[model samples]
Target: MKKKDSNTIAQNRKAIHDYTILETVEAGMVLQGTEIKSIRNGRINLKDGFATIRNGEAYLHNVHISPYEQGNIFNHDPLRARKLLMKKKQIHSLIGETKNAGITLIPLKIYIKNGFAKVLIGVAKGKKQYDKREDLKRKDINREVERALKNR
Candidate 1:
């Protein structure tokens, strides 16, 4: 398990295992009523979530922000596709990059920064089975080295 920062609400750990992240960009979310409240309460899930650029804009898909308990009828949908706020230049750059076969946009983590909800979006490519195995092996070796150093 990885230690999270105080403001980190959720992380898509599987993204690291399944994708080779090439670059990361911090983007703001256009949230609806009660969504911010739920996020502040840590009622968010990044698993199975991904981002996309469409019609010259960026949007986040499949992210789950649980409805607030006290929100009643004002609560937003838990799995709605939310718009992402990013500069036009950045969006254009992303469009060009994602045009490559197999390249994708994925949300790695979400956190509160400067009192606003921000997501770290990664430009990534899918990893092969052998790549996953190699990552696991690297992790095991690193852990063993750490343990040996601690015992020295």
Candidate 2:
């Protein structure tokens, strides 16, 4: 199997463990110069980030992109809400999905693709405690099976 590219800047592993992702969409971000510079330096965090569709637009919240060290006066806010660029049809579809109870838009990861910063958003459903436990058990079982096969 091939490994993921180094282009991935940040990932929200907690979001994956806490929510069941039903679908994923890639969206571009409208970032300031310093913000993009910081991202390229690996100074971004997606652990607490989430996406919201408001007034027919998608915005990302709680993602932190630290200010560039040399940016000085031009540095952007570290925790500011950033705009996400998506097609109108995609935004409308996300609006419908998010209106359903327990459904939400979560930022799964950020990566640089073809010189552009992209966010991978997941349409997710909240998982109950038992559901999380069950998922953990299933993962453990899969790992054990893989180990057994490797040793055979």
Candidate 3:
């Protein structure tokens, strides 16, 4: 028996800076052949992408999967909305949290696990200006501490 390794593609670094992530879930993406190829080639971007629970299902929107170089007409649309596979209960809960609690659904990372593409989605709350400032302050403090320790 051999252990399998997970391969990660692009990650949304802006999401962490803009939102406070509460919980994360791994969901499978419904992709076409060319789209899959594009993703495997690291041609995907999740910077402005988000997930939404609509009509009892989750869909990823604004995700850009570049056109596959080899596919002429069969290349999928770069900004097409893709379905995300998750349990029914999870979908319902997410819908409630988004609609009632005012949380957001953010796609954190896209990765290949066991030969299938999986997305790590997070339940997040938008960060306030002060919160972002606090994060920056904390980072600076940590950097100062590390520098002091190195010089000692």
Candidate 4:
């Protein structure tokens, strides 16, 4: 039997801290030769990146794929908008959901799956001040309970 390798590269921790993630979707990215090389070298960043529905299709913005050091002028732009490949129905559904006020499409992570680059996109809503405070309080309470259980 052969061991399977895990396929994670980088994650956007800030997205979880600032937004209430409601749903997640895996989508493929269209990449050029140098761009693929850069990603395989772990030269990518998804933090502060997001997706937008434009012309009935989804495009990722602010996701950086660093230039391949060995490549010449053909290297891809680091911060260029990359198109996300998804089914038409799925794109339409996400567009509808994003139409709701205060809802957003955030990039949660970028990883390699089945020899291709895939991005984990999250449908999220921004948290209000009170909601953030309440979440902190809940986390503190849970930590206290766990500490008490461990000492007992």
- Using lDDT as the measure, the top candidate is 1
**So what's the TM-score on candidate 3?**
0.92
* Cand. 2 TM to true fold: 0.96
Instruction: Please give, for residues 21-99, the per-residue lDDT of candidate 3 as tens digits.
Output: 9999899999986888888999999999999887888999999999999998877989989999999988888887887
lDDT tens digits, residue span 70-134, model 1: 99887899999999999999999999999999999999999999999999999999999999999
Instruction: Give lDDT: candidate 2, residue 33.
Output: 73
lDDT per residue as tens, model 2, 1-152: 34767899888989989999999999999999789889999999998888988899999999999999998787898999899999999999999999999999999989999999999999999999999999999999999999999999
Off by over 4 Å in 3: 1-6
Cα deviation of 131, candidate 3, in Å: 1.1
TM-score of each: 0.96, 0.96, 0.92, 0.91
Which residue pairs come into collision in candidate 1?
none
Give me the runs in candidate 1 sitting further than 4 Å from their true place. none
In Å, residue 85's CA in model 2 sits off its true spot by 0.6
Q: What is the C-alpha RMSD of each candidate to the true structure, in Å?
A: 1.0, 1.3, 4.2, 3.9
In model 3, pairs of residues that clash are none
Q: After superposition, how far is residue 99 of candidate 1 from its true place, in Å?
A: 0.3
Evaluation by TM-score, superior candidate among 1 and 3: 1
* Residue 92, model 2, lDDT: 96
